[model samples]
Target: MELVVYLAGQIHDDWREQLKQLAEQKGLPLVFKGPQEDHDRSDEIGEAIKGTQPSSIYRDHTASEFNNLRTRIWMNKADVVIAQFGEKYRQWNSAMDASIALATGKPLILIRPESLVHPLKELAQRAQCVVETPEQALEALAYVFE
Candidate 1:
């Protein structure tokens, strides 16, 4: 079966590459998408909201609304949502994406670094499974596929 893997975390290039590798090694027909991968207009929303002044409240609101819509769309299409959360990589957008996944009844897998205390531990607990290592993450994905 074709699966869409949505990896939500800090929008860093290296993180996306790593997740892509993990998805590849799974040997499944998986399409990986994330905030950093920006298949939609997420980047445009980021640019529109960047450094917004108090006078630009309307623009900020519009950008936020647009981003929410895009995130919901992505979440709806995902077979599973894997959120990477840690003290250093915690992001509001990632939390929002996780929330969307929950609301849509999508399987949510939360991954946190083994060494660090997860900043969003409570949030992560809501996932279908909380895992530390990449292997654990893959195992969680396999469970979902089962």
Candidate 2:
């Protein structure tokens, strides 16, 4: 059977595509899913489709809610969740996604550098697998989807 995998967080990088490619190369029966990857488009879709908001906060709120619709659905349907934390930014969304994955009993694999291990200790503890690279995350996927 084909497994649905949620590619969450750190959309700034190409990690999602990389992991999908790896899965394809391995002949794994997997389908990669995620919120919209286009940052500008994801942000603007709310205002574009539903009309503009009054202020920055309202605009962001609208956008967040719009994105959350897709995210929530995917999280529920996902057999596995790989949440990536990038080095430059505070990836709070990733942390949230990981928590949701655990709460929903979806197998979670977190990708973040060694530097974050201490700060994200609690979150890491709850995950099924934690790795530093997308390739390593792919390894976890291979094992699960194989």
Using alpha carbons, what is the TM-score of model 1?
0.73
- Steric clash pairs (candidate 2): none
**Backbone collisions counted per model:** 0, 0
User: Candidate 2 overall Cα lDDT vs. reference?
Assistant: 0.88
- Model 2 CA deviation exceeding 4 Å by range: none
Candidate RMSDs in order? 4.1, 1.1
TM-score of 2: 0.95
Top candidate, metric lDDT: 2
Cα lDDT tens digits, model 2, 52-90, are 789888888899988988899999999889899989887
Per-residue error (Å), model 1, residue 134: 4.3
Query: In model 1, where do residues sit more than 4 Å from their true spots?
Result: 36-43, 46-56, 114-119, 143-146
* lDDT for 68 (candidate 2): 88
